[model samples]
Each structure stands twice: as structure tokens, then as C-alpha cells.
Target: MGERGRFLLPKRKKRRHRTAVKMVLAGILLCALLLGAEHRMRPMIETVAAYQARLLATRNINDAVLDIVQEENVQYNNIVNVRQGIEGQVTSLTTDMVTMNRLKAQVTNRVSEYLEKQTMQEVKIPVGTLIGGSVFSGRGPLVEFRLFPAGYVETDLYNDFQPAGINQTLHRIMMTVKVRVVGVIPFYSVTADVNTSICLAQTVIVGKAPSSYTDIEGGVSPFISQYDYGLQAREKLPQEE
Candidate 1:
């Protein structure tokens, strides 16, 4: 109500104004601090997001590379298997060819041998001055009178002979025969023996000297004789025929 009260009131009002101003300044400082914090946090969030994207890209690339590598390995394995199969087939074909060649050679050799043997079995006897006879009274007697120049005889001795005076003669013969080589058959060496009887009582004996009589009585005798020809005669007989 007086001058002192009025002065205090004015001073108090001025103090209140100063306090309000300070509060306003503090509010502005708090707002700037919050804005600065928000700006800094935004950059950190972007950096984290970029790092996550890079990680995802790196993972995807690695997975794709792994898939490609696995595929390549599978292809390589398949190629190797195919190569092995081809090599095996080639080896088997080569072996079969060798076996077939061997069989062909064997068959050829057998055929050649058979043909050679067959060729040797066919031969004709040479008819020449061949003396064949039986023994009569310890001397040689003409049993088979065959003129070598006129008759054609089978050298293999496979034919039967009709004697001039005898009815029949049985012979089991093993002869050592010399045959001239022709083609596939070389010279054949044959051995044969025969049992023959002569009818000397009905036939006349020839080709023996009169003075070279076997018996003192000068008569024919029944006997078995073995005759052998020389190699020269055997060779010449085939050539002449």
C-alpha cells in the first residue's frame, strides 16, 4: 500500500520475466540436442542396412558358385565313365579279332593236311619190266605173268587181278611203295603184304633159264615166296607209266 511495497512488486515482476526467458532457452537447447541425436542415428541405420544387403549378395553368389562347381564335377564323372566303357569295348573287339584269326588259321591248316593225305591215297602203278613170282623147288617161278609195258596197274593195289590159269587168288598185302609226287601229296611210302597161291600144275612157267633148275627132277613145286623191288625200279616204274 505504500512506496516500499510497490517497489518490491516491480522487482519481483522483472525477476519472473528473466526466469521465463531462461526456461525458453533451455527448451530450445533440448530440441537441438534431440535433432542432432536423430540425425546421427539415421546414418547408423543406413550403414547397418547396407551391410545386411552386402551379406545377402555375398551369400547368394557363394551358393551359385557352389551349384556350378557341383554340376561340373558331375559332368566330369559322367565323361570318365563313358570313356572307360568305350575303352573296354575296344579291348573286347580287339580280342575277338585275334581269336577269330587264330581259328581261321587253325581251320586252314587242318584243311591243308586233310587234302594232302587224300592226294597221297590216289596213285597208279607203273607197268614196266617188273618180275613177280613164287618159289617152286627152291627157285623163282613166274606166278603172275604181267607184261609191264602193256598193262595198266593201280599202284595202290586196290583192284583184283584175274589170273590167266587160276580161278582166284586171295592176297593180304603190305607193300612199301614209292609214289611220284603230284600236287598236294608228296611221295607216299607204302607197306603191304599178300598171301597168294599159284596153280602151277595148269600153267606154264617162264622167264627162268633152263639150266638154272631149282630141283633135280626139274619140276615145279608149291611154295610161298616173298618178293621185294628196289627203289630204282619203283621210281622208274611210275615215271615210265
Candidate 2:
């Protein structure tokens, strides 16, 4: 009976030791599962962040284009108003044309100055031009405006109209602004041109007009004579006009 009891005791202790080892192993596995979750979750978070960044970059570039267009419109409005006011105040019939000519010079100078000011501004790309990873995943190949003045001038003449009065003269003021655009992309770049023109027509009844008023947006009947000095970077109106 004593020998039998000794044998049973050894077997029981051995079983307890094995059970403890298994419990320790189970605890280790649970801890491992919690810590390893970071490996899977971190990558997903990074990918989402990258995608959001790409979307923001796209929006910024679009906004940049809009900002440039708005700036050009404001400058043009200013030129037209200032020129009209200056000429409208003139009392001499001869001075009307002379004032308009002077106004052209001022417009040219204004455009030149605007281009010069823009040169000081650097076009910004909100996202770093290049993203890492495969080609499809990366953001690169961007376009930013580097507008430089090609030239600007006032042109067009209309002398076919009858004089309405002794002092009042009708005329059209045409302003053209030409700018160059550079497409900055990774590993390659290209340049393009954009041309925009603004037309201001004035007809004073009981006054004299050099001719009729014509515009890029077509004339108000009775064709007007137009001439200009500047790069016609945009689609030229059909010569028939």
C-alpha cells in the first residue's frame, strides 16, 4: 500500500505542473493578440490619412486656378471704370480721342505692373508634389500657374458712325492681357498660353463717335472696326466679324 501511494503522488504532481504550463501559455497568447493588433490597425490609419491628404491637394490646386481668374477680372473692372471716368469728364471733342489714347497707355502700364507684382508671388502646391508607393497610389504630376506677361494693349477703331454732337465722341476701349502657364509635373514640365480680352463701349448721344463698337462677344449690330496690339492667345473671333 505504501508503494502504491508513492506512485500516485508523483503522477498527481506531474499533472498539476503540466496544467500550470498550459495556463501560462494561454495568457501569453492573449497578450500577444492585443499587442499585435497595432500592426494591422496602424497601416490602415496611415493609408486613410494619405488618401485624405491627396484629396486636399486636389482642392487646393483647383482653388489656385479660381483665384487667378478672379484677380484678372478685378483688375479689368478697375481699368474700365477708371478709363471711362477719365474720358467722360473731358469737355473737348478732340480731347476725347486724346484722352482715350492716354487711357490706353495707362492700361498698358497697369497690366505691366500687375504682371510684375504677380512675379513676386510663388504658386503653391499644398501637397508635396510626389507621394510614396506605387504609381497609382502617389500624387504627383501637378500644374501650377507661373503667369508671365506676354503683352497687353488696347485696340479697335470704329469711325463709320455719325457724330451725335460737337463734344461727345463714342469709342470702344479694348484691353487684352496675355499670360503664359507652365505645367509643373514630376520629371517633366510643359508650357501653355492663355489670352483674355475685355471690351468697353461708350456711345454718347448728341456727340461724335470715331466708329461703331465691336467686341469679342459680338457687337450690338452695325459692325465696329477693331484693332489691337497683344498676343491673341485665345481663339480669335472669325475675321468676318
Compare the candidates by TM-score and give the number of the best one. Answer: 2
lDDT of 1 by residue, 91-159 (tens): 100112232233334333432333243321222221221121232222343222111111111222111
Worst 10 residues of 1 by lDDT: 145-154
Worst 10 residues of 2 by lDDT: 228-237
| Residue 58 CA displacement from its true place in model 1, Å | 6.7
lDDT of 2 by residue, 67-174 (tens): 443544432234223222244442222223444454445554554444444332223331223233444343545424332222233333222223344543333334
Off by over 4 Å in 1: 53-241
lDDT of 2 at 115: 41
